[model samples]
Target: MSLPAPLDQIAVRRAVEAALAEDLGRAGDITSAATIPGSAAARVVIAARQPGRLAGLQLAAAAFQALDPAISFEPEVEDGARLGPGDVIARIVGPARAVLSAERTALNFLGHLSGVATETARYADLIAHTRARICCTRKTTPGLRIFEKYAVRCGGGSNHRFGLDDAILIKDNHIAVAGGIEAALRGAKASAGHLVKIEIEVDTLDQLDRVIREGADVVLLDNMPPPILREAVMRIGGRMLAEASGNVSLDTVAAIAETGVDLISVGRITHSAATLDLGLDIALG
Candidate 1:
């Protein structure tokens, strides 16, 4: 698959700058300033502790550059690449104190985003043979939704609507407040622009039938079992995109995919993924 575009350079710079400021504090890296000579130079390598996919090399590079504009960060492999234990992701050469000061912030972005990518890849790989594609939900870290979603793409997964503004998603609550699916769909369709697609969540075959009859752009099959999902897809019959979600895990994902839904949306790929273990160690010549 073609790689997703790299993050906007301005966004990268701003995030790392904020992180470096927060980490530096008023006193700065006092220990490094005191112990490491200003003239001292060091080389470091970021190595993986376990096997997984890579993401956020750009942010890591930005972190170092934020501290020292002259820092040289050479990425050995791009984001979305697979990693093995002891795999050297990138090499950094710069003043010793600046390198030490930026290490944690750089690793923080790298590890969290890599975790998101790796977890997504695990789900994507399982459903690769099926017609369904893995996708991530808005259940992402508050300010890091874009980054996490980008990481999902890095793992060979697809992206859902980026925000409430991206499309009209009439959920269970919307239906309840709007009185019924038909009313909700009617209101959404009336308000939506020519380009906006409307998706609605349904939990039962009856609701799916109503949504299909009423006409929607996509149907979210919320928490339905494999059999129910299969029936829902059959009911859809190519009229609307069918998406399944709720409490999905590795053991059950393959089965869910076999049900032939168009997409499987998982929230944990961002909110609950374990951070991939990566470390910046001094490179010895």
Candidate 2:
């Protein structure tokens, strides 16, 4: 499969700038400045300390380039490429002080984003046998939603709504406040433009029937077990798309996919993914 496009360069650069500012502060890497001569130059390799998928190579490169325009940042692999322990991701050669100052911020972006990609790949691989496509929810970091979503795509999963305005997804509370699913869907359909598709969440097969009757474009099946999900999919019968959500984990996702749902939305890939272990070491010359 073709990989998704990288994030906008301007946005990535802005994020890297902010991260570098946060790390540098007013004093600005006093340790490196005190030890390394301003004229000193070194070559370093950013290597993976554990096996995982790669993401955010551009962001890491941008971090170093922002710090020192003369630095040469060369990536060995693409963002979605799988990696093994001790694999060199990229090579950086520049003034030692600038490289050391940019090191932590670059690795932070790389490790965190690669972690999200790695987790997404795991979920995508588990459900590869079925028609269900792995998706990521909007539960992402505050300022990093776009970047995190990009990471999800890099790991072979699809993105959900990018924000509240992207689509109308009526959840349980919306239904509760709007009186019922029918009313909520009606309001959404009426308010949304002709191009906008309406999706509603339902907790049971009865609600599924109501959604089908009300002509929702998609139905989110919340917390349904595999058997119940199978029954729901059978009832749906391709009239509308079915999306499975809630408590999704690697152990349970395969069963959910086998039930024939069209989408499985998981929140943990971004919210709870463990950072991939990566380290940058100065190459001996």
TM-scores vs. true structure, each candidate: 0.99, 0.98
- Provide the lDDT at 257 for model 2: 100
Q: Over the stretch 1-285, how does candidate 2's per-residue lDDT look in tens digits?
A: 568887899899889999999999999999999999999998999999999999999899999999899999999889999999999999999999999999999999999999999999999999999999999998999999998999999899999999999899999999999999888988998899988888899999999999998888889999999999999999999999999999999999999999999999999999999999999998887
lDDT of each: 0.94, 0.94
Clashing residue pairs found in predicted model 1: none
Where does candidate 2 stray beyond 4 Å? none
Over the stretch 134-183, how does candidate 1's per-residue lDDT look in tens digits?
Answer: 99999998778888899999988999999999999999999999999999
Candidate 2 local accuracy as lDDT?
A: 0.94
